[model samples]
Each structure stands twice: as C-alpha cells, then as structure tokens.
Target: MNFSAPTGNGGTALLRRLVWLRFVAVGLLMPGLTIWTSPVRANPHGGSVVHGDIHIGAGTGGHLQIHQGSANAIINWDSFSIAAGELTQFLQPGTSSAVLNRVTGGDPSAIHGALQANGNVFVINPNGILVGPGGTIDVHGLVLSTLDVSDGEFLAGGDQVFKGASDQGVTNLGRINAIGGDVFLIGKTVTNSGAITATGRVGLAAGEEVLLTAAENASGERIFVRATGSGVSGTGITNDG
Candidate 1:
C-alpha cells in the first residue's frame, strides 16, 4: 500500500519549511554557548622595578611583598590583579615613602583581595581599575587613576600631573582607608560605591587631566581638575555609598 501526504496548503507549508531550512543551512551557524568568568589571579604578576630601589618577593600563603628601599619608587607590571584570599603588601622605608605601580598590559587592574602599604601607593591603568566587593585597601595615602603620569613628573616629586584620553574610568566597590593621609581617585568617570575613610582628604575628580599637589595646610584640597574647554557632561563623580 502507498500512502500520500496532504497537498495544496500542506504542500505550500512544506515548501516554505524547505526554503527556511535551506536558508538557515547556508547562513552563519549559531554561535555556541559561552560562559566567561573573571580570571583568578592570586597575586600581582610580572612585576619589574622600573625606577628606584625595590625588591619583589613572595611571602607565606602566596602573598606578594614588595620592599622599597628608596623614598620613592616606580614599578611596572604586566598585570596587577589580586584574587580573593590573597594579599599584596608594600613595605616602604617609612610612612613618607611612595610607590607608583603602573599596569602595562591590556587588562585592567582588579583588586579583589587585600592591598596594604605603609606609605603612599599610586596605581595607574588606562584600561580601567576595579576594586571588587571583597577588596580592601589600607595605606597611609592612596591614588588610583585611569590617567597617565610621566615617570619624570613622578620622580620629580613636587606636583604630579595626570593626563590621558582614556574613556575607561576608575571604580571602587570595596573598602579603602588612608591613615593620616589623603585618597584621590582620578579618571574620566570616578565612582565609589564602597566605604572610604581618610584622615586627611578624599577627592574624586573626573576629567581629562588633573593636577595633584600637596595641600598647603593639613586640611585642604589636594586634587585640581583641569578645564577641557568643552567641559564635562553628566555626573562625573558618583558616590553611592
């Protein structure tokens, strides 16, 4: 026995289905499902002393310890990311010492752990910077920026000028405390949704360029944003917490 399928409308529907199937077969295949997670970096990797007397070593429990012998030091890293349950510390000469850490890689610096220093710590990455929910920063002074400052300006030590065209900004979603010092966050867009405590001052500036200078008095402004002629739009500085 021979069986025949429905014709007329059924034939039209069958033709349409065949055409659709052919079109899909010739078209680009649907992409496979992809899942992405943040890279787990236990410590700051690929660090090299760029300018100053500094030593990098590992401590117990995968902690990164940087010993800076000079009053001011500059260290460049391929990437500076600390995973949860990790700590990165800087032991400088004293509370007056400072260390500049620049990330040279394409990825931004992710602080998902603990970052502590005895003196001042300056971190610059044009890509962007994120202090995650569990991250913590404790230092005498702290400067986190998406702008760029020349080595000459940093080594000179008086007033450091940071200027860059990077649209990537700096965000803090963790805890930051500066003991008897100031905390400055500079970028195209600066945001703080975490806790920030400073004995001196806390400045968040969003602009193309900014000048950081020592406060004339103990209680004064230390960050000055430059005018870009066109002016900035929207809320440049956001503090939700």
Candidate 2:
C-alpha cells in the first residue's frame, strides 16, 4: 500500500503523523540541554553549607538557621566584616574550638572587629593584645589593641589570651572576673575606670624585666599602679560602689 500526499486521500493523516514526529524529537533534545546549561542549585537536605560559594541579595541579606546542630564556621581573610542582622550559634567547642583561628599568612592577615557571642566577646587589634571570654556582653576591638577574657559564670569555659606592647592601660568598665593569669601593665600610663580586682595572681613586666614604680606623686597626677599578687603595696583602698 503506497501512501502519497499528492493523492490527497491520506494527505491529512500524513501531515498529522509528521507533526507528531517533530514534537517528539524536540522533546528529547530539550531536556539534556536544559540540565547542562542551568546553574547548580543548593541541596539543603543535610544541614551542610559549603565554603567558596557566595549568596547575594537586593540590599536585604541572607539568613542561615541550624536547629539543634553544631556549627563550624571559618573566616580567613585580611578582615571579615559583619553588619546588621547576623546571628550564629556554636553548640560545641566552648573554649576548645578555635573559632577565631589564625590566618595562614601570619601577622600580615591580622583580624580586626568586634566579635560578640551569646555570652562572651573577643576583640583584637594589630599592636594590642587581649585574652578572655566575654561575659554576657560585646567584645570591642581597635586598630592598635586587643582584649580577651576567660572564666565567667555567663560565658562558656575557655582560655582567652591577650598580648600587646602598647603603653596604655586597659579600662574595663564592665564585669570581668579574671580567675587565672596575671595583670600585665607594661604600658607607661596606668588608669582603670573599670575595677582591676584580680582573683588569681598579677604580674607586671616590661621588656624582659620586672618593672616597679616607686612612690608616685598623687598631687602631680601620679601614675597609679595596682598589683594584686604575692604582696600588697599601697594601703587599704576603698572600692567605689
């Protein structure tokens, strides 16, 4: 049975079949091309957010929420900046985990900013040093100094270490109960608006030598020195309420 479109009897039927064949061929070719050209979408099933991937928005921001799970966040840059509406939780690694790990490029990649955890805070700078866990407050940092806190009721258990060769005394207006370590005042000026009461021992050193200031003049703006270690130097001082 030879079917010809010129006879016009089976012409309409042939046209319908031809149209159906073309449609099927297009359907087969489209799916493979589409899959190959599209961008990779996120797989949010396993509670894993990989690095090297960036998410952008229209001036609003992005939110990442993990419920009842641990978080391992790392930022190794010259300086990491955080703006409004950013919250992170670490279920594990209170003092053990190095959340603020050092950058690979040594001192060249020093970090600077205010890091405020749920209970504690840690602030650091280029020429200054701080070592302590923040207790229920924010840790503020400057360009030339650093601060650290440890052993508090509110903040988690950890060893905060601070170091610097600056010549300015640190003013602690907030509550910091230094359980261990020494209060080092290598700086020339000594003034504390915040209380400098130590729980363990305090050590004052200056360039590989133990520094001791003798009989500073009170009337001529004497540089006050308070050491709470083995011996008490000054007479009984009143604690301002």
Candidate 3:
C-alpha cells in the first residue's frame, strides 16, 4: 500500500528537524544551538518480566542484559530509554523467540545508544518512541510502535493487533537493521530520516489500529493499518532518507 506524505504540525516539525540535521552534517553548528539528546542512560530500569521466564542482569558501564527462557516473553517497564553510549542486549532462545516490552510510566522512550537482540523485539510506548541520531538497533526482527497490545493477545501468538488513542508518534533518526527479519514501525505519526536495512519487508503504518500478520516465510510478513476509520486520522508516514 502507498503511504501518503506526513501532514499536520507534527509533520512540519519533523521536516524541520530533518533539514536541521542536514545542516549539522555540513559542520554548521551555531552557538547555543539545542541538540536533541536523551536525558537518560542506555540502561533500561524498572523492568520486570511480567509474563515469561527471563533473567535480568546488569553489567558494568551502563549495560543491561535480558535472557529469555520462554518462547514469548512480556516485559513491563516504568521507563525504557538509552543514552548515546549505553547498551541493552537481549538473548532469546532463538531467532523466532519474541519479546514484548511495554512502557507504562507515561513517558516516551528515547533510544540513542545500542539495542542488540538475538530475536524479535517489540517496544510499545503510548507516549511515543524516538530513535535519536546516534541510536542503533540490531535484531532479528523489530517492531517499534506507539500503539498498545493486550497481554492476552500478545501471548496468544498469532497476528498481533494494536490499537491506541495516543496522539504521540514514533520517529527514527538513527540506524536500524533487522537481520533476515522484518521491521515494522506503527504510530499515529511515523517518520524515518535515517537508515533501515532489513532482508525482509519494512512496513510503516500510521493509524490508531494496526495489524501485524505473522511471518509466513523467511522473508517476513505484512502490516495493515486502517487509515480512514473514525478517530484514525494520523500524520501519516514520512521517510526522508
């Protein structure tokens, strides 16, 4: 499906940021210029395994690791963020293992460091999700959304449906690579001005309700979004890179 260009004030702001980033690339740094940076470190805090058997550990120098024993795991976090030099690693059982990370502390997640996962990783934050300029994500599969999915539906292990009323959106200004997997970005507004490499499909859906079909082959699956329904107007999707 064709995604229209981003509209509304949010879209305008994103375009402006993209332009400013271009200026930054040319070594144009004005005095007192404000740069966007995450206020937190790379370590993810206040995380608990809510629906699976997992081990959480910390290492020196702002590193966090999660070892999952279950095929599907659900983790709830008060806040999930990463700074420029921090790292969060996930060790799953296999490439098909999936982890759902839901942030409930009414704050957006800013990922600016590195997030490495052996399997699929889903991050849901109603406030929003930002992958800043220095951020990097390497995973088997990745889903970054501002939508909400129920725990029952998540563990049921079929096509995952997400719905939410959040006005905030998801933005990516860094690098995301899904090795032999798909990358899905869903939100009320979705913008990508960085690099995204995936052997499978790259789906960007903007709406209140989104459907992520299960992968059928090694390539990946599809993403569907209801764009014209009531209360489903969004800024749409923008990819400047």
lDDT (10s digit) by residue, model 1, range 106-208 = 8878888999999999999988888888999999999999899999888887887788777777778899999988888887777677888888777776666
What C-alpha lDDT, on a 0 to 100 scale, does residue 156 get in candidate 3? 86
What value of lDDT does candidate 1 attain over all alpha carbons?
A: 0.74
Score every model by TM-score: 0.81, 0.26, 0.81
Candidate 3 wrong stretches, greater than 4 Å: 1-38, 215-221, 227-231
- Kindly report which residue stretches of model 2 are placed more than 4 angstroms away from their true locations once superposed: 1-92, 101-122, 127-165, 176-191, 195-241
Q: State candidate 1's TM-score.
A: 0.81
Q: Measured by C-alpha RMSD in angstroms, how accurate is candidate 2?
A: 34.3
Q: For candidate 1, what's the RMSD?
A: 19.5
Kindly report which residue stretches of model 1 are placed more than 4 angstroms away from their true locations once superposed: 1-37, 217-219, 233-235
Model 3: per-residue Cα lDDT over 106-173, one tens digit each: 76899989999999999999888989899999999999999898898888878777888887778888
TM-score attained by model 2: 0.26
Comparing 2 with 3 on TM-score, the higher-scoring candidate is 3
Report lDDT (Cα) of residue 237, candidate 1: 53
User: What do the candidate models score in CA lDDT, each in turn?
Assistant: 0.74, 0.23, 0.75
